[model samples]
Target: MRPLEGHHAIVTGGGSGIGAAIARTLAAQGARLTLVGRRAAPIEALAHALHGTAVTADVTDRAQVDAALAHARAANGPVTILINNAGAAESTPFARIDAAGWRRMMAINLDAVFHCTQAALPDLRAASAGRIVTVASTAALKGYAYTAAYAAAKHGVLGLTRSLALELAGTSVTVNAVCPGFTDTAIVAEAAANIARISGRTPDAARAELARFNPQGRLITPEEVAASVLWLCLPDSGSITGQAIAIAGGEVM
Candidate 1:
């Protein structure tokens, strides 16, 4: 039988990129999935393809999160696995960072995790084995130029994950963070395009510049990130909480 055959999962930001990959991976393991995202069309299409549910909610809004959870519960039962994958990143020089940008970063990256986890906590606790996986980033583990706001927000996510892991110790729940670097996603493609515009480099050269951050000199695949998340959700991984597993090809180590 599949490891997650009987579990129900809620994956935030499940419309595309890493979230979409994780949702597909979990579904393959037989977890009943609810793909939650701000945009309904993408997640709805994916959910139909995967035989899962799709919920539209702005994770930063508490009421929206609660409503989404309610809908998910009705469709797939209580959530035994919660993937806090909804987040955004921005690159602005410290001197140029404004209050609006800082707040936006924190709202999506850190605040959303808090809201979603709280909403899902009861369901997670009721399960024999529960998992909460947050998709953070390499910025959470270290510093980066022109990304002070983004880095700070991601760092807060890691801090929250560690604290909750310990707070829920002795329970059936496990909380952890997966941090990937220079991933080959739409976000990275936009960054590469921006680099090309700013530096007059070819698109391929711009992408290579971002990939150079990893010692392997390649972008991390969404499938690779999904694999890590799947491993954490396995029942055998109950003891593996409070970890910031870096999927950055030794870049953070």
Candidate 2:
């Protein structure tokens, strides 16, 4: 039998990149998957491929999240694992970030986490092995240039992970965050574009510049991040809670 044979896993941002990778990994281990994303086409296609259910909803909105989760639970069972992987990052100079920019970052990166965790808390608390793994970034651990708003929001989510872990310590729930650095995702492409615009460098050059942060001279893969997330949801990892597991190649350490 698969390790996650009886688990019900809900993955937000599950249409692509790390979220999709995590969903695939969990489904492989026998967990029922509910792919949640803002885009219907992508999530629906991926869900079809993986034989999972797709529910399109902007996680930053509470009403959308609640309705989405209800649909998910009705399709699958209650959530035993919740992956908070839906987020966005805007790279702008501190002085250029207006109130709208800062609020947008917080709403997507931090507030969405709060809403999802609360919405899934009941089922997670009742599950025999409840796991919540958030896909945070290394920016949460350290500061990033021209990404003050993004970093601040990431740090807030990491703080939430820690606090919620403690609050749920008495229960069967475990909350953790995975911090990935310079991942090879569309977000990284956006960052590279920002760098190219600022430094007047080629996009490839900007990507190389971003990859230099890793001593390995390469960006982390979504599958690498997904593997760690999958491990955290395994039954053996029940004791590993309230931790920020960095998937950076020595960039964080």
Candidate 3:
């Protein structure tokens, strides 16, 4: 609808799955984009296909994130919309969760959000109006049996979301988070694999286990999450800040 016409957007982890969907959806709404990811291949491919810019950087690295955002601002415009969609999750038993795992999870999921949001705050403030959407998971709102670390990190993301919303209260910038349940993405596939290995069940069975968590008996699609994000970026959505809308087919309820 060109609601975002003349705007520039930065989507972390825009290489595939929900991130890619968000990138394409924003592009469709007439926003020029800068896609960021650790790997260059997918971002390059997406940038080429969608006529967007691409940057390869690990979001956890403050220097790298600053460089990427600088490149994005130089190539496009001040980032008016930012989607903190880059995250990683691994199912580990509470007792077996190693220090490295915990640090890595927090680095990519929590620290990355902090770094990128801080890096983009000046531009967003300069714009006088901006949107910051973080793609958290339903785990942020509830505890999962074997996903303590992941859930904790996502909870941190939501905390940032709400706190930023309050901090920017009365400002034109709106901050919100979308919590999706059992989304059909590589993250789910990794979860399925872990479940299979741990529980000695077939991958199909583990996958089904996650699907059953959704009342619809199906995984939510990336496009669906993207649509929700697009909604938040609309001019009329300024009043939606500090909300964590769940796309879980009634599962969260």
Local distance difference test values of all predictions, in order: 0.95, 0.94, 0.93
Model 3 residue 237 distance off true place after TM-score fit, in angstroms = 0.6
Off by over 4 Å in 1: none
The alpha-carbon lDDT assigned to residue 95 of candidate 3 equals 99
- Per-residue lDDT tens digits for candidate 3, residues 6-115, read 88999999999999999999999999999999999999999999899999999999999999999999999899999999998887789999999999889998999999
**TM-scores of all candidate predictions against the true structure:** 0.99, 0.98, 0.97
Best by TM-score: 1
Cα lDDT tens digits, model 2, 96-184, are 99999999999999999999999999999999999999999999999988899999999999999999999999988999999999999
* Clash counts for all predictions: 0, 0, 0
**183: Cα error in model 3, Å:** 0.8
Give the Cα error of residue 33 in candidate 2, in Å.
0.5
Candidate 2 residues lying further than 4 Å off, grouped into runs, are none
Clashing pairs in model 1, backbone N/Cα/C closer than 3 A: none
Candidate 1 has an lDDT of: 0.95
- Choose 1 or 2, whichever is better by TM-score: 1
